[model samples]
Target: MEIRRLAGRVRTAIARADQKLVTFVQSHANLTTALVTAGLALWALSTHQSAIVLRMAAAGAVGYFLGLTPAVCVGALSVGFSVAISLEHGFSISNLIIEVIGAGCSAWLGYQHKMQKVRQEQAADPHAPQVLPWAVVNEIRTSLAAIRFLLFPLHDEEGSRENQALQQATQELSRLEALFREMEQRDRAGEGR
Candidate 1:
């Protein structure tokens, strides 16, 4: 009975620790990535090993899912550290190129993965507004309104193909404006409810 009790206690402790780890990772992902990258760079610098370059690159790629800024910073640090170490050892151009290429590929892969995840989330919630912040959305709308005003004259210009295209564009813009208004009204109605 005592052994069973001890086992249960151990399991509970492990579960609690796991939860704490998850909470920490989620809340401080950017900081965590930065620290991890820094540690990897330091370790590579101390060991003066070329193989560690690959590990740093892998860390950078994985860091992408965390956040772009942190990942980029980490990638830059990794490359810089690798280069510094290489210069001290023998300054191999091929090694420097490889490190640079690895970092670039990691950054690109991470960006693509992040974008794909965002696209998937948007696709899953089609009714949701685009991922842009409200300020950016407002700016874009304002610019579009200006463009529409500029094109307004073209809409009435005599039977040229360009005028016809302009007319269609203006009509489409009106539809979009109506849609935005409707969306705003729906949002207000939702808030009231």
Candidate 2:
């Protein structure tokens, strides 16, 4: 009974720790990525593991491109440096090829991961506008162009009726843009909460 109780307590502690860890990672994703990359690079270098170094570099490049984490650059650079060191010992074309292939695959996977995350966010908040739909943006642009063309003759006049009308149209467009921006900000704030 004592052993069982002790095991139960241990399991509870582990569960709490895991929850905390998840929260920490979510809150400090960038820092976590950087630290993990550094640790991996250090391990690979210390072990003289060329494959590990190459894979890390590739993964880093992918993450960097996807804007997933800035630390990916550090990982890629560290791996490159490690590979150079290995080259000093013995130059192997096979190792270089592996590095290239690993980097390519990692980048592809990172891009896919980024797209998936974006899709998930959109699904979670259907009302939140991730981007202005192309058609709407194009319509706005067309309206602005028409307004400009119509008001071209009044460009030099400051107090004329045509000039005032032009200013009003421009202001209206600005207000619309501001409204979209405000909605996006509110959506982001809601997500944070």
lDDT of all the models against the reference?
0.67, 0.65
lDDT string for model 1 (98-193, tens) is 555555555655665678688999899988553646875886587587657656653455567656667766776776688678767877897798
Q: Candidate 1, which segments miss by more than 4 Å at Cα? A: 1-59, 128-193
TM-score of 2: 0.34
TM-score against truth, every candidate:
0.38, 0.34
lDDT of 2 at 24: 90
- Stretches off by above 4 angstroms in model 2 are 1-79, 129-193
Model 2 residue 94 CA deviation in Å = 0.8
Q: How accurate is candidate 1 locally (lDDT)?
A: 0.67
